[model samples]
Target chain A: MKLTILGCHSATPRINTHPTSQVLEIRNHIFLIDCGEGTQVQLRKNKVKFNRIKHIFISHLHGDHCFGLVGLISTFRLLTREADLHIYAPKGLKEVITMQMKLSDSWTNYKLIFHELTSRESELIFEDDKVEVYTIPLDHRIYTNGFLFKEKENERKLLLGNAEEAKINKAYFRKLKQGFDVINEEGELIKNDTVTKAGSAPKSYAFCSDTAYNESIVPIISNVDVLYHESTFLEKLSHLADKTKHATAKQAATIAKKANVKKLVLGHFSTRYDNITEFINEASEVFENVEVAEAGKTFEF
Target chain B: MKLTILGCHSATPRINTHPTSQVLEIRNHIFLIDCGEGTQVQLRKNKVKFNRIKHIFISHLHGDHCFGLVGLISTFRLLTREADLHIYAPKGLKEVITMQMKLSDSWTNYKLIFHELTSRESELIFEDDKVEVYTIPLDHRIYTNGFLFKEKENERKLLLGNAEEAKINKAYFRKLKQGFDVINEEGELIKNDTVTKAGSAPKSYAFCSDTAYNESIVPIISNVDVLYHESTFLEKLSHLADKTKHATAKQAATIAKKANVKKLVLGHFSTRYDNITEFINEASEVFENVEVAEAGKTFEF
Candidate 1:
């Protein structure tokens, strides 16, 4: 799985810094996450293919999180994109985007679908044969959800020499790969473990942002391969974070440590600070594997 | 009057070229015109003071023309702007913007006033003591208006030397500047034109965009100092212009020549043609003085 940070700063877009937006490529899906203002330009700057973005996941309806969505939709129409697009966001987003389209009298030639999310509990929002996505309910000033993308386990590998030694026919090879014992041509039952080994472990990634320090999400995101969380402030500004319902670097690190995630990526830094090294330094105090999410940087897991 | 082209390309924004947006400074007022997406970043790149803008004029409701408005409004709130903001746009813009604010639960601390325009004829939209703004109705796919900004005769520059030579009292100098003939202390009337000449010829600027080649606007924008007109295509694609309700470079030059404007500024070129020198060459063939609107380029009249 690969994740690209198109933008990570919080609140407002500035000359060199942008608001929250990212692109995640996993299992043949290029998913856009949290399209803030100027996201389309950021996507162009990052060299991400616009046509590859079929599914968009918005964490909330804040301007900095979802303002670029309507523009992206309109640009798609101008570009003559014909693929169906899906948006999974808060319930109010459908009304906002549809209203803009209606006012402009411009609608996409493609099938624009909206999956309005309102459930406050962890539920499967998207799934396919290769991947599954679930919502991680978050605490914020408004209703929000963090998405958890998990890759499904692959089929067990086949041991050619062991299968041939067992005299297993070609038809029985499929059952062996499925971890099932099958009768050979001689009517003798074969054990599945003797012929095939287990597949690689499934990997998962969790995205959390614009939320206060909440431990309830730990169980849902436990043991994920990577966790990207918002660290809007440093420990020195924890009081401001409390008031704004945002997370401090230390608070995000605490959540990562509690969830036992393999790696922690901190993002959504407030624009007030000229330097962000302190975020990593503060997060490292709680979790050893921590990295700051830099704009245009890509992470592979 | 100073005009800054923040962005002038047509259709959607790209890596280097942006959609339609500009800043016009007239009579101590900074007016934002047609704020497309990424305009705030463009303003920052151009080093424009965000707080100085008090009014915004949107020609139409197309995404490329006005998508950046809500983001700018939200940014103003984030920056804690306290001054009132006025937006002059088509009838449906208020509902669209207000609904987005309502959905995000983020309203501006500053008063956001909307002046919805629905008239089909040319009408005065804004006026102050030193400046007057009137809408020039244009033919487009949707309801659209071009703005004509005229400096109100500049208070007829006070010819101190002439006034003193005429033995005009200091208190009566105001009357002379107001173009009023005054009675001298000797009980003789002095003509106003004898002391003062016309102030700078009363410079006027007209902005016409996203419209087809229509001759009706000639009378409204006649004899203006500068005319900024949209030339979405070259003469080679004049057929496309007719079909899309846009103007060609040659057609824009025709309008400039017929209107008898001093300078013609052609902009909103389609991204298809990489080299824009042809647009200037084609326009200058009909109009003597022509300039192409470029991003980050400023024009003074």
Candidate 2:
């Protein structure tokens, strides 16, 4: 799996920086998370195929997070896209989007679907054969959610020489890969453990932003391979962080350390600081594996 | 008056091209017309100061035209701007913007006034000492409006050497500039033409986009200094233009010639045709002084 950060700033998109938006690639499918304004331009710059984005997950109705959504939908129509698009966002998204389309009198030629999230509790929002996405109900001033993308465990790898010697049938190959013993045509019991080795470990990525430093998320994203948390402020302005319901670099690092995440990627920085290396140094004090998120940077895991 | 083409391409923002957005400077106040999705970036690339944008007029709620508005407003707040920004847009804009702010809880520190347009008829939206902005109802799929930015009648210039020789009092300076001969302490009649020359000739600019070839706007912007109307298609694809409620190069030239505009600027070209010199060449068949709107190019009148 690979993660690409289209924009990582908070509050707004600026001349040099962008708002909250990211792309997660897993199982040969690209999923867009939190499309901020100017995302289409960023997508073009990053060389991400526009037509491949099939699913979009918006954390909330925040302008910085979902403002690019309506434009992207309308652009799809102008591009004459015919693929069905599915959106998973908060409850009011349908009303906001449909109203703009109604006012513009331009409807999409493609099939558009909206899956609204009304539950305050954590729920599974998206799932497929190789990945699953669950909402992490976050504590914020408004209704919000954080998405957690986790890769499903792969089937065990078959040992080539042992499977061939055991005369394993192609139909029973699936059972062997699932770590189950199978009887061969010679009436011999083929031990699954002898014929197959365990597959590589799966990875998980969690995205959290525009939320207070709530410890509740630690349990939800426990042991994730990579954790991208919002660090909107520094320790010097921790007071402003609380007032705005945002997290500082130190708070984000503490959560990453406590959650036992393998690596921590920090973003959604406020436009105050001229240099962002301070955030990296400060977060490194708490969590050793801390990196600052930059626009147009792609992180592969 | 000066008109700058920030972006003029239709649909999405392209590499060298942009969506629909323009800057018309009238009476020294920069007015941004129809902000597309990448307007903030385009504005930065063009080196236009964000603070110089006093008013923004959105023609419709189409994603390509007005999607970048919210981001620009949010960026102004992030810059800690104290200026009062005004927006003239469709009726549902307030609801869409306010709801996004409510959801993110990121309120603007500066004053934001939205003058929503609900009427189908023409209305004067903004007026200052030297300029007036009026809406021109257009034929589009949506409830859209075309804007006419006209320079108001300027005050007469105070002829420098002549005024000094005429012994004009400082208190009567205002009256003298208004082309009224002031009565001196000893009653003396002075010819107004001798003391004052003509001020700068008033120049007007009209912006029409995403509209069909309708002659209704001819009366509103008759004899305009410059008319930048969307010519989405050439005469070869005029049928497609009619189907999409867009105009062709020939149609725009016909409007310009009939309205007696000094110079006609054709823009918002469809992405299909790469060579756009044909648009200008074709429009020049019916009207002289026809130019194609190129990005980052400025025209001073």
Give each prediction's DockQ, rounded to 2 decimals.
0.79, 0.63
- Over A112-194, each residue of candidate 1 has an lDDT whose tens digit, in order, gives 99999999999999999999999999999899999999999877999999999989999988888888999988999999998
Q: Compared with the true structure, what per-residue lDDT tens digits does model 1 show for residues B164-235?
A: 888888888888888999987777899998887767767899999989999999999999999999999998
Cα displacement (Å) at residue B125, model 1:
0.7
* Interface RMS for model 1: 0.9
Candidate 2's docking class is: medium
Off by over 4 Å in 1: A170-173, A184-187, B183-191
Query: B1-301, model 2: which lDDT tens digit per residue?
Result: 7788888998787667788888887777989998988788788888888898979999988777887888788778778888999999988888887876765566889899999997877789988888888998988777789998888888999887877677777788799888887875566777889988888888888888879999988998799989998899999999999898999999999999889999999999998989999998899999989999988999999
| DockQ, 0 to 1 scale, candidate 2 | 0.63
Candidate 2 CA-lDDT value = 0.88
lDDT of 2 at B154: 84
Worst 10 residues of 2 chain A by lDDT: A10-19
- Best DockQ goes to which candidate? 1
In model 2, where do residues sit more than 4 Å from their true spots?
B80-83, B106-111, B118-121
